[model samples]
Structures are given as C-alpha cells and as structure tokens.
Target: MMDSPDSLVYLDGVSKLYATPQGLLPAVRQVTLDVRAGEFYSLLGSSGSGKTTTLRLIGGFEIPDSGRVMLGGEDVTQLPPHRRNLHTVFQNYALFPHLNVAQNIAYPLKIAQLPSAEIKLRVEAALEMFRITGLGERRPAQLSGGQQQRVALARALIGRPKVLLLDEPLSALDAKIREEVRQELRELQRQTNLTFIYVTHDQEEALALSDRVAVMQQGRVEQVGSPREIYDCPASLFVAQFIGKANFLTGRVLQTDPLTVMVQNLPIRASAMGYQPQLDETVTLMIRPEQLQIAESQPDAAPTAVQAATQAAAQLSVNQLSGRVIGDTYVGQLLQVQIETALGRLTATVLGKASLSSEVNLTWLVSACTVIPPALATMPSP
Candidate 1:
C-alpha cells in the first residue's frame, strides 16, 4: 500500500480457520501472496471462499492462525485494525447514522485530532475526489445508494489510508451507476497510488478492474494470475469451471510436446509450461466458449490448421458430431448458442446470430483448445 516503488504487502503462509462443530474449518488455508505497490489486485470468489477473510486479515480485523502479514515489509500481524492505516468500505457503506456527509468525511481527521481548518480542507478535498461536492451536507439517510457509497469512500479516503479494502462496495448500486462508480474507483486508485484489495464474486468485474486476480475456492487460492492468464490458461479444474464458460473433454494423453499435447486422440495445444506430459497420462482438454468457432464444411483440400487439427489422434478418438442449434440467446454483442452434437450438448458464444434457424452445423477449430493435466482435477490446493 506504500507509495514507494519498492514497497509491497505480503501474506506469507497466512491461514484463517474457525472452530466448527465438526472440526477446524479452514476459511483461508495458508495463503501466500504479494500485492505490489500501486497494483489494483482483486480477491475474487463467492461467499465463504475466504476473499473477505483475506481483506479482514490485511486490515487487522481478523487474525490468521499462523504466518506473517507484513506491510511495506514490516511484520504487522498482531496490529489492531485501527493501527494498520488501511480503510475498508463495505457494501452498505457503514456511515455513522447521526453524521452528515461533511462530518462523516471529516470524522477520521477529527479522530486523529487534526485542526478544524485542516479537517475542513480534507473533507472538501475528499468530496472533490469523488465528485460529490454538493452532497457533503446530506446525511446518509438522505442520499441515493450511489451517493452513499461515495460518501463512504470519501470517509475512508479522507484519512489517506495506505491500502483501500473494498468489499463489493459497488454491489448495491444499479447497473448503470455501478459501472460509473466502478470507473470512478479505478481512476481514484490510479491517481492516489493506493494499493487496492478488492473482493468480488462477479467475473466481469474482476476481469475488468484487476491488474491480477487471486481466484479463491473453499478458503484457498486456486489460481492467482492476470485476467488473461486465468481465463486463457487456468491452473486447475476449479479455475476453468469458475472463471467462465469452458468445455472440458476428458481424455488420456496420446503424445506430448513442450507446447502441445495429444489427448484422447485430440491434438490439444497445451499451455505455456515448464513441464511437458508423459504419453498415456490422463488429462483434461479445455476450450473456452468463445475460443471455438463453427467452421464451414469443406470438401477435400490440402492441410490447413483445421485440417491438421482434424488429423490429431484426439479428434479421431472422440466421435465426430456436428450439431444443430437447439436454442439460442442473444446477449449484447454476442450470441449464446446451444448445440446438440452427437457427442453431447455444448455451449458457444459467437459474434451475433448468423441465422435464427434451429439448424446450424458446428465444428471447432483446434487452435482454440488446450490441455490441462487430468491430475490437476484431484490435486490438493496450495
């Protein structure tokens, strides 16, 4: 959260567990992460996935079972929430009931015992930062949800907290306002140089806002990578299924190479890996919904990329089933189509409705698929 270029916040082997009736329920199991200074990082997961717990741990509202929480490389695991110099903005914008916007923004400065003139200056500046200058006199009960969120943000920012903890602060607003505020938050983070630890279950929000994301599940990080890395090449089965629409075809490795793998007779392009597969190993082939395209039926021709794909053992092993469109849904700028092929039902996203007819032939380009070692499905999370 420090503005210094060399500073970072780290959670080394940080674990948070609860005493449940059955056993010690781990909410966050030995998470080790580094949030570089000035990065807009997100902790993305559903409820109980330990994202909020991570935020609370860094903010000092919750303690980890074991490990270190360091700020600017200084150990601060035992520090109280108030001593962490981080501010948290909740979904409901927990503003003081009796305080008006001006007082709410000024509250932190006042609590720090700054002079009245300085408090006024800070409050005005905070309001300006959020473009809510005229609403400073309005109490929380009198403002719209979006305005209330701004006030809460202003209150948190007035103290100039090193890190900003946003717990789905925009979730309560309408779609339009949510997008507006989302842009506002990102711009503010850019201008302020404050490290942000954002929590969210929404995939698009995470993809759009984060410099990097730590995708969580059942209290542990499954994959931590850039939006593109996580989406294009997921580390585990959980991550592939969690982040977006993915088609997985279970198969065994037929051949291996550093850049690609032949699985279940399908020539599957593998992710950028330091390790290659061994032949005959079990593996999962993953293709994103958008990655695949409906290839035009072709007569005999020389080997193209698709032809090379058609020749892969994986393609031969799996039954060839071109499908007809059973149904389709138009989602802004894209078409979500359901295809009933001989293999099974598969989903795809195309640019737009090519034809409204229920009969649409389907084939996928091999260039769009990749292989994930089947061992990952059962592998223990770190």
Candidate 2:
C-alpha cells in the first residue's frame, strides 16, 4: 500500500524476523501504518509487542523482512541508518561521556563539516531551545536525568530531521519528571513542526502524548485511531483491555435494533454503534467502570430495592444489576467498588466519598456500553 502524499512515514505490510535460541521468532508481523507530516503518532503495546521494532524499522536501524518502508513518499527500506533523514532518541540517553553538552549537540553538525562559526551558533540555539542554555560546559554525567534527556533532544533536533523516532525515551525518568518532560516534548514538537513517531509500553503516556495511536499486539496492529476513538470505541478485545480498564460481560444478542443482549440470561441494554448483529449470536459486552452508577439498596428491604432493580431492568435503555459490595479500592479521587452480581463479579467506580457497602444496585446507561462480536472477543498472546 502506498502512503498518502501527506504521510511523512509509511510502513506497508512490514515484518521483521529474528533467530533466537528458541528458534526463528517474529518480532514484527505484517503491519501497515502511516504517520502524517508534522503529526505526533504513537506505536503502543506491551513489552515485545513489536512497538520498538516498528520504530527501529522507521528509523532504518532495522530493515523489514518482506515489506517496504517509505519516508516522505520515497522508498527507504534498504537504506542505511545514516542515509535516512530521521533521528531516534533511545530510552537510555546515549550521550558521549567525554563530550560536553554543546559539543555533543554540535557533533552532528561537525560531522557534516559545517563551518565552526555555524556550529557554535546552532549549538547555542539548540541549548536555548531546550532550556539548557547555561549547561553547555557540563558533561552528561554532571546533568540530571531530565537535563540529559534535554541534551539528547537538542542533539537529535540540531540537524532538523524530517521526522523524529522516539523509543520509550522518557521511560527512564521519574514519574514527576517524566510528566514534565512529556509537556516539554509536546511543546517542542509543536514549535519545530516535526513528525514524531513515538513508541512506548506505557498506556497513559501514549494516550496523553500522541495525536493518534496504533495499538499493537502480537506484532500486529489491533487498532489505529485517535486516542478518544481508541478508548471509547475499541476495534478489538485487546484494544479494549489494553487502552483502559474495562468490565466485560459475556452475553448473547437479543436484538439488533436499539441494541440488546442477554447476559447470564438477563437482558442487557447496550449501544452497538454501527455493528450489525444477528439475533441470538453469542457476544461480549464492555463498559467502563466510571460509566456505572451505584445506589445503596437492600435486596430484602421491603421489596423496594427489588422493585427498583426490576424497573431499571425493564427499561430497554438501561442495564441494571443487584449485587453485594464485596470490596472497594480507593484510587485517587475514585473508589473502585467490586460487586458480586448474580451473573458474576463486576466492578464499578464511584466518587470516593460515596457510602458504599452491603447491598447495592448497579445501573449504567446503554449509551455508555459497547458490544463486541465473538470474532474480536479474544486477544492473541504475543
């Protein structure tokens, strides 16, 4: 598949193989992806899910076994790393210990044989661009992790590559500093208008940093969409589970219109989006924990709670379940309450201040749920 004219980087049916002691292993399967010019795109997955390998393929560090890699609409699959106009920043800030900050940033320019005066001007500009103006004389060992990362970025951007490939570069920083650097990286990308193809195993980092994300599993791209689209309307079970915490219920299709399914023989109202479901087909239902609402009600208290549950269930636009509050875990501002429903165990998130204990009725709007067909219900292991 050829990349669109707007794409700065394109990978078409790319695959990479490695020989391990276990035998020949496939690090990356037939994957096709595109990153628009000046866009921030991310390849996200778990360790060994082929995200880093995909980034390496884009940067020309590794060639694909059977597919083409195009940079700016030109084939670069057989090109050497130095021949590509893309630069990569590895997880470990690869800085020379012997060189000072300015020298390290100017190395690429020096290698290009630019004038000494030009090198000095660009090096100083790079330092100020990364907010490390006065640290030019300091060695990499003398700088903090964040500072070292800045120097690495300055060095990579000093040459003004067409695209930047980042391989889990911020994984080494502390949580606080990692977040701060995330903002800085985004700002820098905007200021430079450089296409960034970032790879990471951190789910939150991908969601927070990328304009679009390609979720990979077992060397294959499970889904590609904007962060919100990926999170709210996952294309497969792997994406639903990988992108966020999802509560799943095994069910069978009850009706295609107004979307209804039967979970443990109980009719569950759901939103099926544009999917056409055959009646009585077995399927899975997914809903976010925060979408569920809980209210304290005794199952045996004067039949009031039972009446309410029944009424809620009768409504075709809502799914209702009564359960016992088995336990609750406090996560920041939300309390994740686990409930033992009649069908099985389920979890719901409510405000931390909610009085959650004993019998409770769980209700969630149909619009907040997603129905997954049986084909996309299972995730292949990497």
Candidate 3:
C-alpha cells in the first residue's frame, strides 16, 4: 500500500496476544493499516476492540507481538516512547493538579530541556492556539472541565510532535463541551498540519472528524475505508449493524446480476454496483434508512422497483413490498419509520421536513437496495 503517493504510517500484520485465565485473548489480530500523510484517521470501535492498543503500538507505548509499525518509511516497532516523535492526549485530561495551565503545557518542553525563554514562548503559543491564554494562570481545578481538557491538549501539542494520539480525548466531556472540543481538535490539527490517530466509539464523531476510519471487531479490523465508504458500503453484517443504524432483509437468492439481485422474494436493483450470488444461497439485503423513498412513484422508473403502496392496492407490481407502517417516531431532523414488510421489519428514515402521512406507504428506487450475501466477506455496496 505504501506504493501509493502519500503513505506515511504502515502497520504490517500487527497482532497482540494476552494470556487470559481461560485461554489466549488476541486483542489485535493481523491488522494491516496504512495511514496517508496528514490524514485525520480514526480507529473506531467499542472498548476492547483494540483501538487503544493500536494507538499505543504506534506511539511505542507497547510493542506488538507480531508484525511491524512503521512511521515515515522507518521501522519504529521497537522504539521506546521517548524516542518516537509523537504526543498523546489522554481521555482523563491527565493534568497536574499542582501546576497551572502554563506550567502544565511547559512540562514537556522542560523535560526536553529547552531553554527557559523557548519553553515560555512555546507554552504561550499553545495557550493562544487553544484560546486558553487567560486560563493559563489558573490551576486545573480552578478551570472548567472544558478548559482543563484544553490544557491537556495544549500540553500535548506544545512539543510539536509529528503525530498526535488522541485516546477518546472528548469522552470525558459532556455532550455540549464534547462538540466544542472535537471541533477545536480538528481545527488545531489542520492549522498545525499534524497527523492524528483518534480513537473513538462514537460513530457520529468518527464520521464527522475522520478522513478515514478503521472499524475493528473482536481482535481484527473488519473494514478500512473512508467514512462515506464504510457507512454506505459496509463490508459485513457486523459493520452494517455496528457503524450506524441499518435495516437488513434476510432471504434466499434466486437470481443475480451486476445491477440487481433477487433475494427474499424481492428483486433488488442497486445503483450499478450489484454482484451475482448463487441461486438458493442465503443472502441479506441491506439498506440504510435514508436511502429508501416513499409516496407516489416518479416517471421513467421501473414498475418492479417500488414497493406496493397500501393505499394504491391495485397499482402495485414488480419489486413492490407489501408492508404497513408499524410505527413512526420523530428524531430531531428526521422521522424514523418502522414498517412490517414481507421480508420482515424494516426501518426508513425520512427527512424531518418531509410531509408524512399517518398510514405511511412508500416505494424505493431499485438503486437504493443493497444485496448482501449471507456469511460473505465483502459487504453489499451502496
């Protein structure tokens, strides 16, 4: 993968094994990842998914049991933490209670033995960058949680580390403050041109902030792709269910084509990205809530594409599903509608502003459906 134009960090088949009481627990299993230069990469997963372990390996905090971690074309798998050009922002905001903000930000520079004037200059710059200049005189306890978090950030960035490791840095903050800090982190990274490895379990945050996201499950990575790619083109049922909210239909494949697949007694034609699965094979048809459309059908669309409308009973044909709106709930800017179709219960998210009827009946373009082969490795395309 480094044969690409801009590969900056490489993890080659890295694995970590722990001797548990029951048996060996593999925290990370043969995961290979390539981070391009200046990319805001997020290792997204639940706790114990190896996201933190990956970050520590990259930062030289822990050595991998197998494989190598490379940075800037050099192998640093065995390098000590002090020898690595990296900085870490812990979730706990590991600030020194005895020290003020200025002192805390200056700690790293002091350890590096920089001149007093230079340390002061760097601390001032970091405080100014985080917009916490005035709070620098206050101890961590004297500041708000947000301010204290920024102090931790300033401390990490003060040393001008080539790579920044953020271990759920915003997880400790409340929702309102978390949003603010996440934005600050992105802006700080862009302005400083720093490569960041962010670990987070929040799907929205990962999608909003990362240029690329690595979705890990159990001990191995399930998919490595852009947020859009992973969100829309989930490679596995686990991914489809994990990354965000998704509705899947399980059925037996009867026919197939590059543009469509006949599964679960439904003919699903996706937007030019379908694959041919063997007949009689169990397959899952996956579709996001937002991808589906409701109400009257449009001109120049397929007759078999839209699901059968409950109101227009006689007009139904082709891929039309026979389902009823089981429930509809308002979710801020969207309406999540659950329907009982022939395939099973499926959810569709309509725009908040969209005009909805009490008894919802809908039709979707064939291009919106994704046919996922059951137990298959590759996921259904968007």
Candidate 4:
C-alpha cells in the first residue's frame, strides 16, 4: 500500500499474537491499512478488537510478529518507540503530578538537549495553542478534567511530530465536556494539518470527527470508507448491522434487472449503485431504521387517493409495506417503532412524537436497501 504517492503511514499485512492460559491468541489478524497525510482516520471497534494494539505497533511500542510497518515510504517495523517520529496521547492523559503544566509540556524539549531559549519559546507557544497559558503554573490536581486534557494535548503537540496517535483520549471526560473536547481536537487537527490516527469504539464520535473510518471486528477490518458509504452501502451484513440500526429481510431473487431485484416474488428497485444479483440467488436486503416512514393505515380511505399517493412515492423509488405496530419506544428526538409484517419484525425510526397506533404503513426508498450474502445474514450469534 505504501506504493501509493502520498500515503504517509502503511501497515503491510501486519499481525500480532499473545500466549495466555487459554492458548495462543491473535490480537491483530493479517491487517493492512494506509493513512494519508493530514487526514483524520479512526480505528473504530468494541473492546479487544485490536485497535489499541494496532496503534501500539505503529508507534513502535509493540512489534508485529509478521509483516512491515512503514512511515513515509520507509520501513520502521523494528524501530523503538523513541526512534519513531510520532507522539501518543493516551486515555489517562499520563500527566505528571509533581511537575507544573509548563514543565510537563517542556519535558520532551528539555530531553532533546535544545537550547533553553528555544525550549521556553516552544513551551509558551504550546500553552497558548491549547488555550491554557494561564494554567501553566498549576499542577494536575489543581486543574479540571478538561484542563488536564488540554495539558496532555499541548505536551504531545509541542514537539511537532509528523503523526499523532490518539487512543480514546476523550473517553475519560463526561458527556458534555467530551463533546466540547471532541470539537476542540478536530479544530486543532485542522489548524495544524497533522495526520491524526484515532482509536475509539464510539460510533457517533468516529462519524463526527473522522474523514474516514476503519471498522474492525475480531482483529480484522470489516469495512473502511467515509461515514456515508459505511452507513449506506456496507460491504457485508456484519458491517451493515455494526455501523447502525438496520432491518434485514431474507429473500430469494426470482429475477434480476440492471437496477432492480425481484426478491421473494416482489420487484424491488434501487438507484444506480452497481448492484447485480444472479437468478435464484438468496440474499438479505438491509434498510436503515431512519430511512423508513410510518403513517396511519386507513382502511376506509378512497383507493383513488391511496393510488395517487403511492404512485408519487414510487416515483421517488420508495417501497411500500403494510404492518401492525408491535411496540413503540421514546428515545430522545426520535420514536422507535417496531412493526410486524410479512417480511418479519422491522424497526422504523420516526422523527418527533408519534402516536402509538395499531395499523401503519412503512415506506422506505429502494435506494436505501443493501443486499448481502444470505449465509452471513442468517449466521447465528456466537
């Protein structure tokens, strides 16, 4: 992957393993990743998904059992952490309690044997960069969680490394402060134009802050794409379910067209997304919850009005289905409605408040449905 022109960091078929009482375990499978210069990329996954281990390998804190780690087209797999040109901001902040904020930020510069004047100048600039100039003389105990986080960031950026590794740095902060800090970190990355490699399991944070996201599961990358692509056109059933809430419909393809598939004897249409299914193929169609619209089903309404309205919806490529409301849940800004239909139990996310009614119509765009392999769709949970 490093053969590319502007790629800054590349992991070529990297893998790491550990021996425990249970036996040998693979922490990171044969994974290959390429991060471009000045791009915000995130490794998003749950616990034990090998994200933290992968970051450590790039920083030279952990060596890969096989394959190479390259930086700026040069091999650095065997180099020590100190020999690498990158800095890490850990989740715990790892600040020193004995030293003041200024001293903590200036420690790296002092160790490099720079002149005192240059060290002082860089420390002052870093303090100002993080908006903590007034807290320079304060100790870690005297600062709030947000303030201490800024100090850690200033220390990491003071040396101006080529790459910055963030290992769930905002996980320690509260929700309100975490959002504030997330915005600050994004703005900081933009101003410096530094290549940031962030690791987190929070989908919202990853989607909001990253230019691209790499979703990992069981030590391997499930998918890598922009937020929209990952959410809309997932490569596999696992990916579609992982990125967000999706309703899966299992069916067999009776016929195929350039832009549509006949699933379970029903012709379903989709926008031009390059989808081509073979005849008699069993596939699972995925539709996101937010894409569905729910309206009260009127049995006594005139068929003419319903037909006209249905035709308009179909012109926009919307698919219609009749279902009975099984349950309704209030979740903040949206109401989660579960319905029982011929396709099975489906969940729809309706905006604002919705009346808990018995009969309803579910409307979704055909372009929103993604088809995946049938075996994976029906795979039993482990």
Q: Give the candidate number with the greatest lDDT.
A: 2
TM-score of each: 0.86, 0.92, 0.87, 0.92
lDDT of 2 by residue, 1-382 (tens): 5468888888998999989999979999888898999899999999989998999898888888889999988999999999999888888979999999999999989988999999999998889888999999999999999999999988988998999889898999999889989998998888888999999999899999899999998798988999998888888778888988989988888887877888877888888782557898877788999998889876455767887798756676777788888888999888998988988888888895445457888889888888754455454432
Which stretches in model 2 have alpha-carbon errors above 4 Å? 298-314, 354-356, 373-382
lDDT of 4 by residue, 198-292 (tens): 99999889989999999988788778898888888877777777788999876666556534556555666544352466776766788889988
Best by TM-score: 2
Which pairs of residues collide in model 1? Answer: 264-314, 265-313, 265-314, 265-315, 266-313, 266-314, 266-315, 283-374
Model 1: how far is 160 from its true place, Å?
1.3
Model 4 residue runs over 4 Å out of place are: 258-275, 305-316, 373-382
lDDT of 1: 0.78
Computed on alpha carbons, the lDDT of every model, listed in order, comes to 0.78, 0.87, 0.78, 0.85
Model 2 clash tally, residue pairs: 0
Compute the lDDT for candidate 4.
0.85
- Write one digit per residue (lDDT tens) for candidate 3, span 279-371: 666666677888766553345554563343543553222145545666788998889888767767778888753333334445665555666
Number of clashing pairs, model 1? 8
- What is the Cα-based TM-score of model 3? 0.87
lDDT, candidate 1, 1-382, per-residue tens: 3233465778888888888999988889888888888889999998899998988899898989888898887889999988888889987889998989899889889889999998888788888877789988788899989889989988888888888889988789999888988888888889888999899999889999999999998888888999998887777788888888888776556556434455334444554342255776666767787865654344455678976885675553332335677777889999888777654577888985655445554545444555553434464444
